[model samples]
Target: MSSIKEKLSKPFASLVAKRIEKWARNPEKTQQKVFRNLINSATDTSFGKDHNFKKISTYEEFKSNVPIRDYEDLRPYVERVVNGEDNVLWKGKPLYFAKTSGTTSGAKYIPITKESMPTHVKAARNAILMYIHETGNTQFVDGKMIFLQGSPILEENNGIKLGRLSGIVAHYVPKYLQKNRMPSFETNCIEDWETKVEAIIDETLREDMTIISGIPSWVQMYFEKLIERTDKKVGEIFKNFSLFIFGGVNYEPYRAKFENLIGRKVDSIELYPASEGFFAFQDKQDEKGMLLQLKSGIFYEFVEADKFYDENPERITIKDVKLEVNYVMIISSTAGLWAYNIGDTVQFTSLKPYRVIVSGRIKHFISAFGEHVIGKEVEQAFNEATENTSITVNEFTVAPQINPNNGLPYHEWFIEFENLPENEAKFIKDLDNSLQQQNSYYYDLIAGKVLQPLKLTKIKKDGFQNYMKSIGKLGGQNKIPRLSNDRKIADKLYELQLTK
Candidate 1:
């Protein structure tokens, strides 16, 4: 059964790919028009009876007239609908809510309508297609694909149904092909989150996986578990795996360790996925890769990062955004979110059709210490430091911790070292210097005493895995906090580091 599905999926995906390729040729215009049409249709269906639906003539009109909404603003509407209220957001009855765990926020219940289900599946398929194109590996159509996703079961009035997204995809995937898959779901669904992860690790270890996909931090943790579970190394267990598809977090910090674990130079595919929608994916051919996507289904807006929410925020349509300028992204998707700030920052890498790189999150910036350090900035600093010092970091986390004695703040770095050269102090100095040069706020904090000098703490090899274990978040979908804005978590982590 799975073999038959694999054979069919190839041609079906190929047909989708050809259409996508044609659309990518003139994506900016194509996407803009498609966005407009979807918005118009949805608006017509939503308000057509009460009053005539207003047609937006220009991008400016769409940007200025349509009020921007955040997730919090939609909470009331979402909650009402979830509790059985009829609403415009749900064209048909909503099947279920896709519960997602956030960084600072505990959990978010995103309303998932029947219409939105296709977008999730399409996005997953797009991710696979992007992976194939980048690596020039056509075998993926024939090979088993693994999606390291959240659990597939949902708690409901009539017991737990399939997770809104995961369950739907699982149901639709050709059963013959199902045997080639692994999920963090299964019987572990009823277990405590901690025990569930251990069960997931146990199950994932049994597969002879060809492709592995998940959040990078979580994937790394799984590898650590594999090390503990068996005498075989990660390279031995995943010897058949050819590609690693990662999203949801930056992978630069763990790239070296991941490569070492895999035992070969494995290709990586990056994706931009959120509860709202899977917005963009890396192009297969480019070095950094181009971001291509379903332009017609979603409208995109960009506001300059520095100018976000200004008195007159300078806004650009997908067509107008320039290469290399970091901008906060806004999306008007089929989910009935209009002019919504998705909390992600992106920069265009090419303009012929429009390709982009996910820089970081708007909320992920470090500004409490006055260092306006974004993810890209940190990535640059890390790369420069790594190149200069020749020290490879397995995993790292940065946070601002208030000093208990002085009530002052300081930037703390928790790093897992693979090999520290004899001149460790010199290496730390060089890395610090590189950060100061790359980030002015970091320089100010060090020089003007806004914060204490940067401090580095080395952990035992695979220290991050142990940290995750100690927190009872050892595997599956959980991730180590990469950057902490609050002091409570940071302080606790600091104490953990001290004891280590």
Candidate 2:
């Protein structure tokens, strides 16, 4: 039966691939349609009327009327919806509120309208379908798949279901995969992530688990658990497991460690999903970035990352985006988030197909002395330094040491090493040099004596895990920042550092 179903999926995948390629090639026209549709759909809503959505016919008009807003900015309209008001942002009350933990605000409730929810399910499905079409390897469809995520259980608030985005997505998995998916509903519903993972191990331990998807850190724990039980690499246990899907954080820093855990390199898909909307996904195995979903209900606007805080900085659409330029992605979507700043910074790697690599977060970076070092640069630098070497990284983060005890202030890297480097001094030098090469400001800072070479503090094994546990964020979607402007994370990490 699985074989028959697998055969059917290929043709369906091909059709979807062709459809995706159609919009991908006509990016400008595609976005314009989404833009018009969004404006038309919400023109009757409170936000639309207040923002002059009826009079907005052109991008310039829309841009002029709507100011870019973050979660807090949209909270007024969202609060109305949360309090059971209908048509507050969208056409009517949303189907769900993707409840996410906010930095300042206690909990952020991003509305998931009936019109917007399908896109989340479709984008994830399409990501895998496109993979099948491009790779011509759909055999994994016959095997059990697992997406390590939050509980499928949801809470009701004012007639709307509310939960983490992953949890919300869990309820929508296709019926065909009900039998093919791993970790039974009971196990998945376990609230404690550590306990849930253990339950998953007990359930999936001798099963044909062929597809494993999750955040890398949490998945690492699962892999470690499996290894502990059987003393075997993940690949050896799940002989047919091929596809690894992940999002939320870059996978490069964890690549070496994963390779060690799995015993071999396997194919993986990267997705750009948020509580706001499902944005992009890896459509090709060889591509440098995920293909931006232009034809999706979300209309995208890009603001130059460095100029994001400037007085009325230009917000350009997809047509104006250039290669390698870091952009803060803005969206007016069916989810009724108008000019919403998703906070992710991305760099376009391919213009023709609109492929983008998530570079960093807008609020996440190190600019202590004006050397604005980003997450991508640091990850690249570390990956470059450790490439083909024995030093495997478990987890890592960067922050500025503004007032060091010694010579000069420098960037401090907190890394949990799976295997310590053979020559620690050279590793540090290579890592610092690579960062300098990637970010010109960092290079100038070193040359101008503004900052010393970056310093590395080796964290004890499972130190990052312990830190997360201490904060009650040990698992499920909580990612360590790659770089921070402040020492909040650095100070905490220092407390977890291995004694020299």
Candidate 3:
């Protein structure tokens, strides 16, 4: 009976893959179908009678009619549904709520519906497949897969319930397949972050793991713990590990340090995952990324950042979406969310359906001193500065501060250098010049006599991790805020900035 069920499900999975591949190549058409399906599903689940949300009928209509609803708008709806209101936007009882620490806002509890589970699983699967295909490891299924995920126990109703998403997925993953897996959530160490790290370390040491998955910072911290616990180098222990799959945060900042620790150039796969939906994954091993499965039970919408607030907002259909254009992602899923603005920015690399990249977040931009700097701009500046200078920065953070002497604002950069140069002044000037050339607003602010001069501070090794730990958010989804815009937050970050 079990074998029969497996056989029946196998064909559906294959069909999903084929359709995804096709939709990836022609996203516009797939999006149209997805949108129609979303409206139908949402109507069926919420209203009980089929009704057209006029604003969302066409891509342009969706943009014009449905206002971009942020986390705040959805919070009330989530609360209502959780309180046992029938005929809510979401049909089923939320399996779990994924907890994400908000940057400007406080903590966010995103509802995870059963219909949304397939999206996460498929995206993860696609990412793994892409890594294997890229590395020519077709027999990846033969080895044990290790996942460093969140705690699986949720404190609820004066007792403990299995963690919603993590616990639910743990329950569903096939027993035969899961028998060969090692997960951080499977252990009894669920109370403290340190305990979890120690448990993960102990498990990794015991297993002959091939593929390792987690956020880069935590993984690096774990490697550091391993080094401290034993005389064995990270490279030696991770030598047998073939693939390193990472997501949730930027890895570019810590690239070189991570490579040095691993001993060899590590093969990595990036994923764009969230509680709302798994969204996209790196599909082809060689190419940067491919949109894996946008049509798998969820409908996607993109609003032009410039016109998101317009009276008649303009929305880009999957066909209308262009390459290299940054768009705010809106999703309508089986979870009953309608034109939900997720606050994420994405750029398409190709016209084909699945050729898109998760650029960054809308709110992550830094205009601390009115320079309007963003993650891509900062990354470009770092690349340009490093190209001409001898200093190699492993990780960095930029905070805008008021110069007490001049009563003007200036950018204070905290950088971890790989090799220190004798002429520190010259290196700082080069880096400043790179930023000035790359960012027009920054250049004008610095050279055009708008703000105080740019300052560079050299930080000690593992300084960022230590600083992040100080905030009680050391591992997992926590990251060094690339740009500090808030005055109070910037003040705190300014104090953490290391000099010399």
Per-model lDDT: 0.66, 0.90, 0.66
Instruction: Compose the digit string of candidate 1's lDDT tens values, residues 1-500.
Output: 34554556556667767777787787666867766675566654432222233655667667656666677766666666566655455354466666655555666666555666577667766767655544446554445566655555557732213253444455556454566666534743533544554676667676667787888876765676777788677768866777788877777767777877676777777877666777777666445644646463677778999789677787777667888888999877666666778788888887765777877778777777667777777666666667644467767767666654664577667777776646766666766787788777789888887776666766666567667777666655566655655555455555566533
- Over the stretch 1-500, how does candidate 2's per-residue lDDT look in tens digits? 45888889899999999999898888899999999999999999999999999899999999899999999899989999999998889998999999988877898999999999999999999999999999999889988999898888999988999998888998898999989987888888888878998899998889988899999999999999999999999999999989999998889888888989999999999998889988999988887999998877999999999999999999999889999999999998999999999999999999989999999999998898988788999999998999989988888898888877789899988888889999999999999999888888999989999889988887888888888887778787888888899988777877765644
Q: Model 2, poorest ten-residue lDDT window?
A: 491-500
Best by TM-score: 2
Better of 1 and 3 by TM-score: 3
Best by lDDT: 2
Task: Mark the regions of model 3 whose C-alpha exceeds 4 Å error after superposition.
Answer: 1-19, 44-57, 60-65, 103-106, 155-172, 184-189, 290-292, 306-313, 387-394, 417-423, 487-490, 493-497
What TM-score, over all chains together, does every model reach? 0.85, 0.98, 0.86
User: 1-500 in candidate 3: lDDT tens per residue?
Assistant: 23443344445545655655776666667667877776655554443232345334666655554555787876777666656654566664665666677665776767666677677776776666545444545434545667666655564521212243444455555565675577644572364667888887887776666677788877877777888887676768755676788887666656666766776776778877777787777666667555646676667768776466677576555756877777888887776666788877777776654566766667766676677666666665666655544555556767766655665777777776776656777766776787778677888888767776667767877677667767877665566766655545445444776556
What's the residue-level lDDT of 347 in candidate 1?
84
